[model samples]
Target: MTSLFVDRRGVVLELESGAIVFRENGERIGTVPIAPLSRVFLRGDVKLPAALLGKLGEQGVGVVILSGRIGRPSLLLARPHNDAVRRVAQIRLSFDEPFCLQIGKTLIERKLTRQIEWFTELRENDMQVRYELSHALRALEEHWPRIGHASSAASLRGVEGSAAARYFSGLQAVVPNSLHFSGRNRRPPRDPFNALLSLTYTLLHSEIAIALYGAGFDPYVGFYHRLAFGRESLASDLLEPLRPLADQFALALIRKKVLEKDHFSTTEAGCLLGKAGRTRYYAAYGEHSETLRKGINQEIEWLTAQVNEIMATAEDDVRSEDDFEDFG
Candidate 1:
């Protein structure tokens, strides 16, 4: 299944015979079969009947509404997985300090490895950027062994943050000079490159959160990222390995000039992508969504297996203890 992105202003959506009909000014514009859609992203002034939302929920289609200047998202999810056992196991694992640390180490290791791989790829391809990419690669390589040595989540996060700084520095060198990208900055990203990164990361996070919810995992209870109010920590954890991919997508957009300086405007709220830029951005993103989703699903499957293995081990240990007590 694919995702449907509706960004047009003043468009009305209706459910007509198992298809989503798009109308503007009372004239039919387009229609899409709901059967082929896994999710729908609605942005700006799009209108849709309440009945259509009901139909979407009934069909197990997730809805993501992007609002405000920066397009903060609000998720209207379908019915989550019926199995609560996996959620219970996840909660149990979250409290297991040793398990959490191991998971954190694994996540950081994977992330740093991917970042190093990307820099290595760039270093091999472009001689002009070699100096910068080599430096970043060395920094990431230094952090790789540290992930296994990290004693706590706090230390692991520190290693990850340092690696990310180096990665972004390498990225800054590769992007066009006109883009004016320095290092990574967010929460109202100050630069066009940062804006694109923030937007792409948000979409990636949303995709992972939806996948986690569908697979019966608690998105908020993460092993690596500490619990925070309103944060999908598990999704944050799962997205770590894939962040380089998102970063690459943003870089590609800037480097290829699919997104340019003219596509952005700055206000007191900081740099923001205009509607025209977003239209092009979404189109480009659609081309990559399938691959992104497939990667996310693979991660989710890995996490599910890990949780099940941990739960099974715990149960076996309990049974062994009970047998020992009875024998005594």
Candidate 2:
């Protein structure tokens, strides 16, 4: 699956025959074929033809329009499913409290365990991390047992937030200070290296959200992530298991110091990635996306197995294979 990321500033995206031409500075420097593509991300002031979007939709490729400075998706174009009932059923099943919560708990717990495991491995080299990892593990261990008893999404989310805070603290501490990187912040990443990491991670999250939506999950309904305006809570829930990959990608880039200060810019309001920064981030994102997609597909396969087992044990009238695939 290919995700075309467009972050070039002041570029024009126009359909030329069966391909897209990218024109910059009165020159044609790029062309992308409208084939073998899964998604397109429009992230700049580029313009697109209406017919091209229609063709992309017809090809079962997703197109997302993103606004600059906002850093969130603005619009999406995708092919309509012919089997509407199946898609609708998937959404309902994904939103069902019992089913969604159970699956979410499994996902979060697995991810928490992975984070703990990674922390332990890291602590072997850095003794300072021991205290924080121990605390994080303690909280995760304490929080996991309550998943089964959580009555509302809020309770589960609280558990997740606590665990995440501890984990992020440990992760930030492990990085050397020479990189000029600090812990996570709400505003755009202040440093160039952090900006690159953030941009790539955001792109990865957006791609995962699209996949979750295609899977028929209610992207807004979630177990571990709180619901907020324009927040894809369900996507956040599903992304727990996939974060380590992005973390690894960021860590690699930072260690190499491939990102320089020139890659980023700052405004009075916030920092933003420049053209070169976006290009490098997108390249990394494409590589990271391939790895994460395979992992997600594997997770889906595992879930399918568990659902199949449930169907096998339940009465045929109560549980059917049809219902199993709906959530898959």
Candidate 3:
């Protein structure tokens, strides 16, 4: 795979002969074989050699230009892949009511459990308040069977939103100063840490969407999240398991004071994270994504082991110890 090269200070990217060259300050530091690289991400105000665009397409390498924030991608250069047939198939499967509901229920339950864990790790004045939050979360879990029976995407979304409201409300009380958590805004985040969290999650969501698209899954047609114009519904569907990861990142930034008020500047529109804020956020986001990737990979490994154990035990006409494990 081609590794991502980020130029904090603007650099020049040029495809020379059989190698990709990254040049800055009259120095050549990085070179990669054209065939091995998948994507080159330009995070700074760098110049791309427009003459090499045709060759980049032929080499199947993507050059993505980011504007303003390191976390946001502005322009992407790559030959688009056509997967209309797979998208149709995935969309059809997404509408399998029973399957979609079950997956949605599992996703929400996992997120809520992690949210509870995060609260327990916070420094709150009233411990009973934490207990109450836990109780509310447990209430949602206990009623999962009922929520699982939601027939439509709209109904399931209501259940998810209700659970999030309870979770975020308890979370808001724990923060030292009020974050002004009125609602979610995409343009700019309202608070410093929130902005970081939003930027990280949006990038995460887009990355996941690209992976899903590459894997031939429909980027539209979701179970819990609503269908909106130009929204990648399927990516939103898959992001549930990772929401807690983003939540934990936000908590760490606030607790460590890595993200200060000065890191954020308020505009007439909303809050905008400064350059320093973006740097801190990108580092934190990288750590969080790695952690979640390992955790989820471990979960999958355990499931695979259980599956093998089950098959072997059944072959021997006996129940294995792993058979007692309830993956769901």
Best by TM-score: 1
lDDT of 3 at 99: 55
- Using TM-score as the yardstick, the better of models 2 and 3 is 2
Q: Taking the tens digit of each residue's C-alpha lDDT, what string does model 3 give over 1-328?
A: 5335465676777778877688888688787677766555567667657766677666655555556643565434355447565555445546666656666776676776777666666535457466655665575565466566777666777877887766666665655464565434456666655676676676656655554544445555665554678787766876786787777777778778877778888776567777777677666655555565454444334323433454455556645554667879
Which of the two candidates, 1 or 3, achieves a greater lDDT against the reference?
A: 1
lDDT score for residue 327 of model 1:
39
TM-score of each: 0.96, 0.78, 0.70
Candidate numbers, best lDDT first, in rank order = 1, 2, 3
Candidate topping lDDT: 1
TM-score of model number 1: 0.96
lDDT of 2 at 105: 77
Q: How badly does each model clash, as a count of residue pairs? A: 0, 0, 1
Q: What do the candidate models score in CA lDDT, each in turn?
A: 0.88, 0.68, 0.62
Clashing pairs in 2: none
